[model samples]
Target: MTEGSLPRLELWCELQCPDCRTALDDVRALRERYGDALPIVLRHFPLEKHKHAYAAAEAAEEAFVQGRGWPFVEAVLARVTELERRGPELLVEVAGELGLDAEEVELALIDGRHTLAVDADQAEGKAIGVSGTPTYVVAGQRLDGGKSQQGLRERIVALLEG
Candidate 1:
């Protein structure tokens, strides 16, 4: 967050949360506006209430390792209901649809290779006072967008411009 350092946005999110899915709109808009100027990083913050959220987070990490992180996230977020209905199977299905190795995604989930990374993100998120999904940290500020995303994009813009 230093002055003249490249500004980054950390999105603490649960893949299964509906609010997090909605937050993707702002994420997409930011990507469209800033392109590579701004880096929007996704951090896992899977809430315990969501049954499949932890698995989804692990799957996302695997997708990231496979070089299709954002697209996999977007695709998974776009089908939250299906994810809730189908769990790990839905994760594998989405990976195949995106041309990723479906078997590898499944194995990663089962072997727990990405669990440590997801857990670390969750722990870091809690230490940073992230209490809910879709929370954003940018320019040393934490913006909670769980209930509303109003003025968030503007605030980020101001921080980036300031």
Candidate 2:
């Protein structure tokens, strides 16, 4: 796809904690505000400190394989606190909430079937200098910080107009 056809915003985040969820909320609002005019791609960048982050990322990739990536992501974000508190069971619950087959998601997590894809996301983020959660790449401009709705909207508008 050409530059104009590509997504206007791409977010690199981890779903293992509540901070990422907060960031995702802003992303969701931006999408609602811009509609199809702004595209946001979610990439997994699970941190090493979060015990279940890697597994959660694997589950998300499995969901992607099952064509439920976005839903899986939303589920994860919705239960970030639960995931941090209760762990993988929360991830499974989120999968079930998204109508994903729990057994398959579990299998994917156990089998390491999607580990490479998740790792690749992390590698790409590192390559692009993402050393933290909630990093955003907007029209080739990288913004590393927790951005509020107004802040994000302003940057996106500037990118679109520039």
Best by lDDT: 1
**Clashing residue pair totals per candidate (backbone < 3 A):** 0, 0
Model 1, 88-161: lDDT tens digits are 99999999999999899999999999988998999999898999989999878999997788888898778777
Candidate 2: give its CA RMSD in angstroms.
2.3
The lowest-lDDT stretch of 10 consecutive residues in candidate 1 is 1-10
Q: Each prediction's Cα lDDT score? A: 0.90, 0.79
Query: Model 2, 1-162: lDDT tens per residue?
Result: 465554568788888756676777677777787778677787888899999898898988888888998878878878777787888788778888788898899888778888888889999999999987888888788877554434765776677557
TM accuracy, model 2: 0.86
Report the number of backbone clashes for model 1: 0
Error of 2 at 142 (Å): 0.9
